[model samples]
Target: MWYRISSSTVIWVANREIPINSTSGVLKLTTSGTLNIFRNTSDLTPIWSSNASFSVQNPVAELRENGNFVIREENDDNPVSFFWQSFDHPTDTLFSGMKLGKNFVTGQEWYLSCWKNSDDPAQGEYTYRLDPTGYPHNVIMKGQNLTFQTGAWNGVRFSGRPKSSGNTMYTHKVVINKEEVYYMFEQINSSVSRLMINQSGKGQRWTWLQQAQKWSILYEVPSDNCDNYNICGAYGDCNINNGPVCGCLEKFVPIDVDAWTKGDWGSGCTRKKPLDCQKGDGFRKYSHIKEPDTLSTWIDERINLKECKKSCLRNCSCMAYASLNISKGETGCLQWFGDLKDIREVSEGGADLFIRVAFSDSDREKNKATFIISLSVVGGVCLLGLPLAFCIWKIIKKKSKLKRSKGILQGSPKGILRGSSKEHSNMSQKEDPDLPYFSLTTLLHATNNFANSNKIGQGGFGPVFKGILEDGQQVAVKCLSETSTQGTNEFMNEVKFIAKLQHRNLVRLLGYCTDEENKMLIYEYMPNKSLDWHIFNEFRNKLLDWPKRFHIIDGIARGLLYLHQDSRLRIVHRDLKASNILLDVKMDAKISDFGTARSFRENETTASTNQLAGTFGYMPPEYALDGILSVKSDVFSFGVLALETVCGKRNREFIHSDHLQHLSGHAWRLHREGRTLELVHQNISQESDYALEMIRTIHIALLCVQQSREERPDMATVVLMLGSNGELPMPSQPGFFTEGNIVGSDADDNTLLEGR
Candidate 1:
C-alpha cells in the first residue's frame, strides 16, 4: 500500500482485489530483480511483483521524494531512468511530476482509475486519461461512457479549459511527439498538488493547505453545465451565462426548435441557407469562442491564416479554420471538416474560429443594408424629384437634430459633464454605447432614498449603499456625496474608462445615474465587502488563512495585469489599495475605484501631470513627488497592498514596537536578516508549511517596491514570476524607506486626491 505519511491515507494498493489475509506479509526482492510480496516467510508463491523483464546485478527498491516508488541498480547514478516506477500505474491520485498520456513506441499508457469508494482501494468505474485519437486532449470516462472532455490542446491551454492557463500555483502543459504524448503539471513552489478522479467520476485538483491542515480544492472539471461533452451537440454554442445555456451560431437555426425550447438541445442546429461548396463558400469569423472539436481536422504549422483560408476554400469539405497556436502570431492552421461540435463561448482567452458558409449567408446582412439604402435613395429621387437645395437643407436639419440629442457640452464635446442639466442626462449613454442608463426613480427605490442604514462603505468619490433593484438583482450604488472631494470629471472618467472593460477580476459596471444634482454609479453587489474589511479587522482576519491570503494575492496580480495589458485600453489605476479591493462571496478579489485612473494610447508608455493624485503610502516615489505615472505606478501600489495583506496591517498606519519605520521598511529589514517568514501575519504564522510561499510573496513585493521604477517588472513578467519557481533576483531597499518621518510634501488630502 502506498500512503501519505502524514495522514496514512492509502492512495494506491498493489493487491486491492486479492487480499494477503495475513499479518506476516513480507516484501522482498528476488535475484531476478523482481520485487515480490509474499504472504509469509514460509510461503513460496508470490502475491505481487514488480515483474522486471530481465535479471540485473543488484536491484534496489526506493521511494522518491515526489512520491514515486522505483526499482533501480544499486550503483546506478541515473536518477530518472528507473527500471520500474509506481508512477507508471497510478491508481487514483496523480502527483505533480506524473504524466497522464501514452507512449506510442512502447505501447504503454498512463492513466488514472479512481478508488471504488472512500473505504475501498479497488479501482472504481471512473477513469481519467489523455485521448490521442485526433488531437490530444484530456477526457473523463465512466465505465464505457464518455462523461467529459477537457477539449484539445491549443498551444497555450486546453480549448475548453481557459482558466488552466497562467495559473499561479502550478504550470501545466501537453507534449506531443512521435515517441510519446502526455499532459503534466509541475509545482511553481513548494506547494503539494494532486489531480485525481473520484468514484463519482468528477475530476478535481486539490492542493494541500498548511493552515487548514487539509486538502483544498484548487479546481474541478465538469465545473458547469456546459462542461458536459457535446452538451449542445453539433453547431451549437454553449454559454453558461446565457438563460438557456445553449444557442445556435449566427445564420443558423435549431433543427428542432420545439425540442430546443423544451431544453432538449441534443438535435443542435442547421444552417438557414444550404452551403454550396462547389460555388465557393466563404467563412464567417467568430471571436471569443472555444474552437470546435479537432476529431476531423487538418493542421498545418507552416501556413499563415491567409494561406489557411485559401487552403480551406480549395477543399470543399473543410467546415472551419483557426490558428493552431493563438499565442504565436497565428503561424499555423487548424481546419475542421464536417459539422462543428462541442463549441462554447469563453469569456476570456478564447480563440477566434472562422466557419465556412454559403456566400449568400456570409454577406447577407451587409448586402441587405446596402440594397435598402440604395432603393430608398432611388425611390426618393424618382417619387419626389426634390430640388438639390431643399434636400441639402433637410439633411442639415436632421444633422442639427442629432447633434442636439447627443447633448454635447459647450467646452467638452466628448461628453465630459459639468452640471446635472437635462442636456447632460443622456451624455454617458451616448458617449459609451455599451453602458446602460438607470433612472433616478429606480435608484431611489433601490436605496430607499439613500437611507443612512443602507450605506455600506464610504470613499473619496462617494458613499456606497447596498440596493436591490425592482428585478431583485443586488447592486452597489455609489452615490456621489455633496461634500465629495472628487468632481464631475472623475465621475465621468470612471464611467468612460470602466464601461468598455470586461474582466472576471475587475468590478463590473451595471449602470449609471445622472439625475440633476444626484450622481451615482451602479455595480454588481460584492457580498463580502472590501479587502480592508477582512484583512484589517481583528476578528475577521482569522478567516483569512495562508491559503486564502495567497489566493487573494494571486487574484490581485491577475486583475492588475488585465488592466495593464490584456484589456482593450491600456489603463493605469493610480489608486490600488486595500479598500479598493472588494471580495466576492467566494473571497475572490475584484479591483474597484477607477476615479483616479488614466488611459494611454497603444504606443504611449508614460505620462506626466502637475497633479499628483492617490493615497500617500501606496504611490511610488516618482509618481507622488514628480507627477510621473505609468503602469509601474499600479505595480508599486499592488506591492504595498500585498505587504499589507500578508502582515494584516496598513502601511501608512502600521505601528511596530521594535521600529518606527513603515511596513515596507520593516519588511525589508526582516528580509535582510533572513527572517522573511516573520512578515507573515501573526494570525497565520503558525502555518509552517506555507512559510516558503509567504517568503517568496514578500520577496516579490520587495521587487515591486524597489526605489527605481526601471527595475520593476511589467505586469506580464510579474505574473510569470509569481507562477514560476525559477530563481529571482535580489531586491534592493524599498522606496520611501524612512524612520519615524513620513513625507507629505505638496499634497492635498493624504488619503485620496481627485487626480483627474
Candidate 2:
C-alpha cells in the first residue's frame, strides 16, 4: 500500500481475479517460507500467496520505505538477497526506485496495469510497459492493440516529450544492456512522486504537495490529442499548434484528397513521385520533431549517422533513419522500415529524422552547367566583337524591364506609401542597385513548391520558407498568405521600406516576386532564427550568456537608431518584439518584419490611425489605446524586449510566486526595493563580469518603458545609454503593469484594436 498515514492507498494487488468478501482474514508466513493471505475464518483456502521456490533458514517479510514488500533471509541486508517483491508486479502505480521493464535471465517482465474502474481493483484494458522490440521504449496497450508510446529513449529523455528532461522534481533515467532494459525515476529531494496509468489509460505523474496537503498532477503522457499513436496516420506529422493537426511530409500528398479535406487523415499520404530503387533514392532531413514510431525498426549501437543513412539507402525497404543518441553528438543508428508512423513536431529538444525520397535533379547543378555554357558564349561574343550601340540598347531595355517590374506593386492603393513614383525611383536608384527580381518558377524550384519542410516560421502575414537559390545562396521567402488579414498593403509596405534602407543591423531584403496570384519577398536568411527561440526557451536560453544577450540588446538598439534618426526617412517600427528580432550565424541580432511601419517627414513627430496593430505585451499605452503612433511606441517595446533578454522570460507569460503582477511590474517592485539584481535569470551568473552591465541595462530599459511618452528616451538616446556608463534618471511607472490595465485582456501577439 502507498503511504498517506490517514488512509493507505492501495497500490497493488496480487490476486485481482479473486475477491475476499469475508471480514475474517489472516496473513501469515508458514514454515515453507510462503507468505499467504487467507479470507475465511476456518483458514482453509488462501486467496493469495508469495510462492517462494526455496525455503530460507530464517525467513523475513519486510516492507521497504519505498513501498516494496519483500521476502528475504533475516540475516541478509542487501536488496539483491530478496527473493520476491511487490515492485516486480506493479498493478497501476509505479513508485520511486521501482524498475519498469524486463529481466532477460529470469524471463520476468515488470509492467503497470490500470484498474478496471475507480471503485474496482481488477486488471483493466490498458497496460503500460517497456516494448523491447526494435529499440527499448515505453508503450501503452489497449489489451493487444498498441495505442500510445513514450517514444524511444534519446540519451536524455523520451524523444517525443522534449520538455521531460527539464523537470526538477525527479531525475528520469533508462538502463539498457544485454541482461535487462528498464526505465525509472529517482526523487531529487524529499518530495514524493508516483507514475500511474489511470482507468482512462492516461499516464500521469502525481506529486504530493506539502502546502496543499494533497497529491496533484505534475505531468501526463498522451498529454495533448497529438500524443495518441498514429493520430496523423502513416507518413503524416501532427502539429497541435496548427489549425489542422495532421499534415503530410514534403514530396508527399494525401492518398485520399477528398477524405483528407473533410478531416479524415486516416488514409494518410503517399509519395508524389514514386521511389525508383533502381536509380537510387536520397533522404530529406526533417528537424525539431519527434521521430516516427519505432515498432517496425532496427537499431545498430555501433554505427554512426552517416553509416545509418548509407545502410538505409542500400535497403529499399528502409523508409527512414534517425540518430539514437541526441544528447551526445550523433551516436548509434536507428532505421525504420515500412510506413513511418506517429511523427509530430515538438517545440524544443527534438531529434532529426531523415525520410527516404526519390533522388530528383537539382536546379542548382543545372544552373552551374548553364553558367559554364554562358561563359563559353561570352568568349565567342568577345572574339566576334559585337556592336557597341547594340550592347547599350540591350542594357537600356533590361533596365526598363527592371523598373516596370519594380512598379508592379504600386498599382495597389493600399500598398503604396506616402510618396510619388519619382521619389521611390530616386530612392531605389540611390540605395538598392542590386535588388534582383526572382521569377515564380525559380522560387518554386528553390523551395520545392513551398514544402512544409522548407517552412521556417509562420507570422500574421504568412509562412516564411528557407530556400537555396540557383547560386547556392540561401534565402528566406515570405509568401503572402491567402487567409491573412494583412493583405498586399503590408507585403508591399515591407518591400518598399526595407529596399531603400540598408544597415548591418537590419535584415536585408534581396528582392520581390509577383506571379499573378502569388506575391513573395526574398530576404537574406538568419540561421539562428529569432531571439525568442533562444532567450525565452528553457533549454536554448542557456546558450545565450550575459555577453551574447548584451550584444543582442546593443545590436537592436543600433538598428532602431538607424530607423529613427540615420535612415533616409524618419521611420517608426510599429511592430517590434523578440520574434521580429532575428539572430544571425554569429548570434548578432537583426531587426526584421516592418509590415506596419510608417515613415514621417522631418517636421512630423506623431501620427494617428483608427486601426491599431502591434503585439500585446510590447505595445505602448498611447498607441494601443488612442491609436497615437510615434517613435516612442517602438522605444517602449524595446524596453520590454531588453528586460525579457536579461530575465529570460516573456513579459506577458511571466508569473512571480510572490505577487500577481506581470514581468514588468515584478521588475519594478524589485527595483524599488533595491533588489534589481534578483530579476536576472538563473542561467546568468550573478558573479559574472557583466553582472553590473546587466543591472545597468535593466535600469535603462525601465526608463524606456516609462508610462509617459515624454519620460521615455528616443531610440538615439537609448543607444547612447546602452553604450555609455552614465548617470540615469529614476524611471516612472510602466504602463499596463497590472493585469487589469492590459487591453483586450485575452489579446496575444499581432492583435488588432478597433479605435474609438
Candidate 3:
C-alpha cells in the first residue's frame, strides 16, 4: 500500500513486509514499561512495537521535533539513554549530528543509501560514507564500484574541497581518533540549514530563508561533468574553460587519443617514456593545480615543503606531491607514489602540483647554460680584435715600469727584510718579495666604487662585493666597512691567516691592497654564495638533495680537520656557521672569512680572552659564558650547524609545541626518547641510509656541544665520525638545556651572556 503525503510525495509500504500501517498508529505504555504500536481496528493486526529491555512503572511514546518516534519511562529524565528511537533505524535523509562513516573497531557503519526511485523509499544504487583505509577520506560508491571521493582530510580542511573563507553559516570537521574516523557538520544557526543525500545521488546544502518561506540552495557537489568521478583519467587535467576540456599534462599525451577526441577522457594519459627506476625521471612543478587522486599513497604530514619534493624525487614510483591544504601556507605534504587519477583545473584555490617527467624534458629545460656559454665564446672571439691594441699598450706600459723598478731593487734583499722585520719579528726569514699587490684605484674600480648593489654579503669585519677585474675574471673583494668595530686588527688577522694557508677546503685569498683609508682582500668568487642561502630558503633548499648535503657536511669536516691537525700552523676558526661555509658553482663547500681566526702557539692547548665574539646559538657554552677559547669551541659550533642542516631549521629559533626549546635541546630530548628518526626532514628518502646517518650525526653533534669542554669531540674525531660508521659514545645532556621552555622566549630577558 502507498499513502500520499502530497501530490508528488508518497510513503510506500508492503502490506505484510512492514506490519505497521495506519494514520492513527497508536503505541500505548503498559504498567510493565513496554510500549506496543497496534492497529486502530480489531481486524487490523498489531504493527511495530517498542520492546525496550528495561522495566519501569509507567512508559510513554511521543513524536519528536525532528520526526523521530521515541519511547521512554515517565520518571526518567536523561534523554541520552533512549529506550527506543526511530533514528537508530534511519530512513533516507541524514540529519545534522548523524554520523555517516564506519566505526571499524565496532564493525558499525552509519551510511546513506540513495532511495530507489522518486516515489519509492527502498535502497538504491549509491552509498556514501567515509573510508578509513589509507589516510582516511570520504568516498561514494555505486553498488560496490567506487564513483566519487573527497580527498583525505588535512589538519585544516578536506583536501578535495577548495578552502572556504568569509562564510560562517556551517562548520564541518573530520575527526580521526583511536576509535573511529568520521565526518560531521554543524550549523551556526540551528534553524538555518540542512544537508541531504537526494534520490538523484547528489549531496547538497540548503538554507531555509524565513523571509522567502522557501529553502534556498546554498551549494551542491558533482557540479558538472568535470566533477564526475575520475572523468579526466590518470594524470590528466580537466578544465571547463579549455576548448577540449580535458587533456594530459605537459610531457604527457593521451593513452587513447581517439577516445579523448571523442570527449571520452576516462582512458586518461600516459607518459611518453616509461620511468627508469634507477634514473631518467624528474618532477616538474605545476602551479595552482588540483592535485590528482591519491587513493593508495603514503602521506607524511610533518614533512616540510622541501622534504616533500625530495621524497618524491628519490623514488621512481612516486609521481607527484602537493600541499595537503594549500591555504595553510603549505604546511602539510601529500605524495602520490603510484598512478594519479581524477585531476581537474579550477580558476582559483588550486594547489601547486609537481608531476614527474622523463629525463629528456628536464635536460631540454636545463640546457640554457650551455647555450648562453656558447654564445659568449662566439662573441668573445668576434670582439678579440677590438681590444687587442688596447691590451698591447697596457702590457707595454706595465713591463716598462717593472723593468725600471727591477734595476732599482735588484739586490736589496736586506732592505726588504728590514722593512718587514720591523713590522713582524716572527716573520719567516725566506719571504717572497714578488707577492702581488693591487693598487687602491684598481681595487675600487673592480668593485664599481663599492656601490651597494655590487655588495654580495657582509661579515663580522666587512662587506664583500662581486667584482670584475680588467681581465674579466670575477672576484670577491672583502673591504673593511668604516663602521666596523674590529678595525685594522681584524683585517690584518684575516690576511695573515689566509695568506699562509693552502688547502682545497679553505678559501683562497687571491691578493690584498693596502692604501691610506683603504684595506681590501680579494678572493675567488663563490657563485653559489653561502650554505645558509640554500639551507634556509624553503624552495631553494630542495636543490640541496641528500647527496649534496652529505657532501657539504663531509667537506666542512675535512676543512676543519685540516685546520686543527694537518696545517703547519694550528688554527681555530672562532666563528663557524652556515654563513661562513661558501659554495662554488659545482656546490663544492669552501670555508671563508678568517677575520676572527686565532693561531695557537706550538705547545699551547687553549687560550683565554676577556672579549667574547661569535654568533649566538652556535656558540659553545664555555666560550659564550666564560672567557675561554679552544678548538672545542669550534667543535661545538660545528655540531650545532650539523643539526641545523639535517633538521632544516635554525637552532636559535626552533619551536616545537609548548615544551621543546631550541632545535639542539629538542633533538636531544627526542634522542633520549628513542624517536630521533622524528628529527629527520620528511623529504629525505628512507630508502637511503640518511636517517641512520643523520641520527649518528645528531649524536656526534650533541657530543661536541656537551656542557663540559673536555667532553666534546675534537675535529679529528668529528671527521672520522662523519666519514665512517664507527661506534660512538652516547652523549650526555647538551649545553644550554632548555627543554622546559619549549616555547622560546626572549633570551635577552634572562641574565644570560649577551654576546658570543
Q: Write the per-residue lDDT of candidate 1 for residues 1-756, one digit (tens) a residue.
A: 443634654666676656566589888977767888888999998888877897778888888888888888899989897888888888888878899999999999999998776656678899999988777889999887787887667788887764342467788888988999999989878787789898767787887767535565665677556777788989999875455679999888999999999989999999888888776687788876777767788888889999999999899988988888766777788889888988887644567888888887765556777999999988877777668648877998888556534533122213222236666766666887777888766876787766766777877776788788886677998876656778788889899888888887899999898865457899988766788877887756765677678878888998999999989999999988888899764567899989879998989988998777688888888887777899999999998899999989888787789877788988999999999988888978987657778888999999999889999888887777776667889889888887534464212232543343
What do the candidate models score in CA lDDT, each in turn?
0.79, 0.79, 0.68
Summed over model 2, clashes come to 0
Q: What is the TM-score of each candidate against the true structure?
A: 0.55, 0.53, 0.44
> What TM-score would candidate 3 get against the native?
0.44
Global fold similarity of model 1 (TM-score) = 0.55
| Runs in model 3 lying further than 4 Å from the true structure | 1-22, 27-90, 325-329, 359-756
Residue 565 local lDDT, model 3: 83
Instruction: Look at candidate 2 and give me any clashing residue pairs.
Output: none
* Candidate 3 global CA lDDT score: 0.68
Q: Which candidate number has the best TM-score?
A: 1
Order of candidate numbers by lDDT, starting with the best: 1, 2, 3
For model 2, what is the alpha-carbon lDDT of residue 594? 86
